[model samples]
Target: MLKTAAAAATGSALSSLGLRAASASTPRRGGTLRIGLGHGNSTDSYDPATFIGGFMQAFSFARYNCLTEIAADGSLAPELAESWEPSSDAKQWVFNLRKSVEFHNGKTMDAQDVIASINHHRGPESTSAMKPVVDQIAEIRSDGPNRVILTLEHGNADFAYTLSDYHMVIAPAHEETIDWQSGVGTGGYVVDSFDPGIRAALSRHENYWKENAAYFDNVEMLTIADANARISALLSGQLDVIDRIPFATASRVKSLANVKLVEVTGSQHYSFAMNTQFAPFDDNDVRLALKYAIDREKLVQNVLSGHGRVANDHPIGPAYRYEATQLEQRVYDPDRARSLLKKAGHDSLTVELSAADAAFSGAVDAATLFREAAASAGITINVKREPNDGYWSDVWMKKPFSAVFWRGRPTEDWMFSTVYIGKSPWNDTFWENESFARVVNEARTELDEGRRRSLYAEAQALVRDEGGAIIPMFANYLSATNLNVEHPERLAASDDLDGMRLAERWWFKS
Candidate 1:
């Protein structure tokens, strides 16, 4: 069910933003729905191999069809490929492609295309998430026109689920060069136009195999960096849907009769990430002191307005199989924090807290909060804010010392492998522990669910004990949409715009 906050502050916030709450009963269709994207990074490549940005996920969901799709309940199900089965050893999986499926470019999807897509991501030039898993592929052979076989070096239980990832979407075999001009894939919609980092216009593919899919004739996604502007656009009817609704405005947006606020508890964990390779943070006591100084509860209640969940050290949520139950009770303790600082030979330590303006829900304010909290623990913090432009590419990823904003994955292995694995390209922290690495490796191959869960719990405990990451809060994704749009309940933490947006099911209420 949808929850609404009835406070006057929410109403005032909406009024200030020039938005009226949309009525719950209103419904309309056939009109082009404009969406305000809160943040937009580079996603110029149509090739799945090079696509990694959030904007790419939105675009891929609409235009590319993966072999499998994650269902509403987070279970893997067949999509472009009808069904698949793994060999007893789990080293090989065979997929039977759906014959009825065809690309928006009017070409029938074949086993060759699937094999080509997989190979493309496996090539030396690729930067796909499937790089790690695909590197183990010993061979990829097509059985016939519809069946494809994937032989890996070793067993991978999560192999099936990885096929459903947005990055693995199959593309035509003949696409020799990256072409954004003619972004083609076997999906429900065709790209009308793509203006990198600005807007992408998509038109429904009438030949879509899915019945009664993509209700909107056209979808105009506009990247709007300002929260106030996004709210204004939604209220003024310029946008039918909006993403990354400001927490300060969530209450106000919920009260508007003509607007519906959808909140999804996200896998994103906001943290003051320290480059463990450098400085005072390199010391365990210093890291522990910083973690104990900040109050996560206060951040959630006051800053986030109870929209998000409190996080301990691990980014993976409680629902994940490997979450450590014992660490759930870790809380703020300033006295302990001060003592830790003294133990680290720093009665008063000075450090720079770097954060990008574009990071976090209330990033600037969040940094301010951290500064204040550090002060209480007798630690000196110098807050540094960077511009949103090129922050991810030029600053966030390459920074030797900076705050980190990570959107977590559903599985513990995926989270650890991508971000914390010592040699991982995505390991921004540059912090590596041999014991943590060993646990991650064991968890990856552990076929038994219970055993794997235990491994992950131990891995998480190692992170907490060493203070690998300073997580303040688990972020909740909030969005405001016109009540005229139906199926607002489908949104999830994955930021699956096409799947969660439910654009196809929405209709006009006469």
Candidate 2:
């Protein structure tokens, strides 16, 4: 017999154990899927340009469809566009939209909708995080009702994969403008009702293009920012599934026969970001001193409860094809940390770092742990607890230093382009390195694997040594669900919770 799914991760071997229930079951449809997520704010919107949190992305995936999407095994699959072709140079590309695809508003989806939805993030007025990812698009023209041609500023083999981005939601276009506020698209569900961060409901789209999808008649997304509360909801049968269960309380799932804990390791990592433009952090020595102070091993063992692996400060994880693992790991050294702090001319440094559990499971506790460890190096971190309601808008990027988590991108260049590129909207650190930026642009088109690896290795070194981030551990995407919530084997590892597309792919057992 073929090996099936197994529960309880035995170290790193638990890669997408939830996707395989060990025993296969045919999908049964027609029930509301109540999902509880760890974070969401009143700031959530239907506008694709403003979707920052995974909760919003989760809801978006239910109500909207992308041109392309990452399949169960992390390969590209057609969603709206049935097929695509690229020029020999890999710069100019064309997509042929799937026929008979109808929007929730009963409008025909054409190449114009794709062009307008994409341009919403490209223009100068757009402050979206996805701005940098699409900045390379020099132009987009419609060849006809069914075809759209995209011309890039440079050659990129990953151009098609980039279309699978959650931000690339295709909306119904009326003239040159698309009504993003309506939440109408060609997804598997239709927006039944929405209240920003509170809760939203979606009904199955009867005309959904994919027959296997829309299995659940209705789906509901709830914002349960507290970790314990999210797990409690699942245990109480109030929720069918919950994402990002606190690592410490993960064992609670094992005792419940109907509730199962799932773990998938990929590029998901929790990090603390510092504004490089801010005082003290502006000094490279100060950044290095802080990076040296964190005990990554203890973080995985103590804070994460052995649910994750130590990270090397770069966003790249072991899952990515070009992820660099040859570099020496950064170890915890208080004496070395103090030496660097003194070198930076700060004998006893005091700083404020805002934190909340909403940023990630155990984030507040993680900061408290860091505070205790950093005190040994004569560094003072004032951990200010922020409210979950407005943490994303008020505290996150606005604060000089804060704790946050990143579900790493599918590709190295995409990760660098989003957060490390100069003048990019999502450059949380406000860090701009000339050499790293140059390498990011060149490596996108570099077909040679050896040459690409060398470039990425150098970039990783720069981030590890000079960048304003403290990456302690790359986390396993730990979740818990009632047995009634069924999913397929070999789920997408592009990001946590099946790239936040669980609403469409997962169905009720009944």
| Candidate whose TM-score is highest | 2
TM-score of 2: 0.94
Residue-wise C-alpha lDDT for candidate 1, range 297-319, written one tens digit per residue:
88888678887778886677643
Query: Which clashing pairs does model 2 show?
Result: 5-22
| Model 2 RMSD, rounded to 1 decimal | 4.4
Model 2 misses residue 314 by how many Å?
0.6
**lDDT for each residue of candidate 2 in 1-510, tens digit (9 for 90 to 100):** 000110111112324332455754677778999999877778778888898787888888888889987776655667898888877667888889987789988888888899999998888888878888888999999998999999999977677777778888999886667899788989999988988778999999988888887688899999887778888888889999898878888776667787988777778888999999989999999998888888888889887899889998998877676667798988989999999999999898998889987788788888888888899999988899988767778887899999888887767888888888878876778898998888877887665658877888888888888888889899888888898887876666766677788878877765
Q: Candidate 2: global Cα-lDDT?
A: 0.82
Instruction: Please give the RMSD to the true structure for each candidate, in Å.
Output: 7.0, 4.4
What's the CA error at residue 85 for candidate 1, in Å? 0.7
lDDT (C-alpha) at residue 417 in model 1: 72
**Residue 106 miss distance in model 1 (angstroms):** 1.5
